[model samples]
Target: MVDNVSKQERSNIMRKVRSQSDLENVVSKALWKKGIRYRKNVKSLMGKPDIVIQKYKIVIFIDSCFWHACELHGRMPKSNTEFWESKFERNKERDAEVNKHYLSKNWNILRVWEHELREDFDGTINKIVAFIEHAKK
Candidate 1:
């Protein structure tokens, strides 16, 4: 299917897409308030994790339902079915690859879904804190 927008317009729209999301900002701020120091989007990392604690060998990924194709909430775009399908499939594959790489290196990895955070913000925060604390041990 052809794109709805002009080539230049599509380029501009894609350019506006950011590597960091507001969800990441909120979660990072909450963690910071709890005295959990971490780095954001370390490009040197294998997958460029959203949050990383080098001291503890921890990596956290805040995955959007749409982007990561959450089983429960992900929906294919009506406009570009084939493109979105391929994109989502690739995303899931890459996630698995990243998980494998971290596991092989003995790094603690946590992936929080968008709906999970939205459903229970405080609970999710606590879960993350617990995960980090456990990794510290």
Candidate 2:
């Protein structure tokens, strides 16, 4: 029984998800400290990549599990299955387009789910580092 303000608050809460969480931030900081420089939230990019390393031509996207439909933890909401599935599918298609576009342009793309960030901070960073390092060669 929520009123307008409370309903709006709940909607806002549900709709909110930041690009760079503390886990990603910490990993970015560690990588930076080790002499890695990357651009954060480059709007010029089609997908607004979360992190970009120009030197290695690498772009990172910190995708939300709910939005990107993380294969593991992305459960279809039972409340509004049709609406949620459509939304999630659209997001997935858009992600594929962005990834393809970047690949065509010779830019390496990295998409890490929010769950991955929470579960494995350093390991996730390592995956990105490995890609960038390989591109560096």
Candidate 3:
């Protein structure tokens, strides 16, 4: 499928997309209100997770439904189907690799989907807190 815009224009548009999303900020604020301390995208950690509770050795990933290819909400771009498919495949592969790395180090990873957060933000926050509490035990 051909893109309507020039390749350079498309590249510029893509570059304008924010790397960090609001989901991360929402979760961060929730945790802060509860007095739970966390680091955002720690460079030293594998995959640089969205949130990290060093005390609990827990890592949180605020996954985008579109980017992660969520079973319910993910869709391939009609304009660049092949390119998008390959990109999503690589993303899934990288996610798997990161999971393996964390597992080997006995770290707890919680991947929350964008749709899940949007549908029930409070519930999602509670679940993350619960996981952290459980890890403490």
Residue range 51-135, candidate 1, lDDT tens digits: 9999999999999999999999999877768989999999999999999999999999999999989999999999999999999
TM-score of every prediction relative to native = 0.96, 0.80, 0.95
How close to the true structure is residue 102 of candidate 3, measured as C-alpha lDDT? 90
Report the lDDT tens digits of candidate 3 across residue range 55-80.
87899899999999999999888897
* Best TM-score among the predictions, by candidate number: 1
Better of 1 and 3 by lDDT: 1
3-116, model 2: which lDDT tens digit per residue?
A: 335667758976785655675677678779767788887788798887888777889888877778989888886665677889999999999999999999998888878888
Q: Could you list the CA RMSD of all candidates, in the order they appear?
A: 0.9, 3.3, 1.0
Question: Which candidate comes out best when scored by lDDT?
Answer: 1
Reference-based TM-score, model 2? 0.80
Q: List the residue pairs that clash in candidate 2.
A: none
For model 1 the local lDDT of residue 9 reads: 94
RMSD of 3: 1.0
Prediction 1 TM-score vs. true:
0.96
Q: What is the lDDT of residue 121 in candidate 1?
A: 96
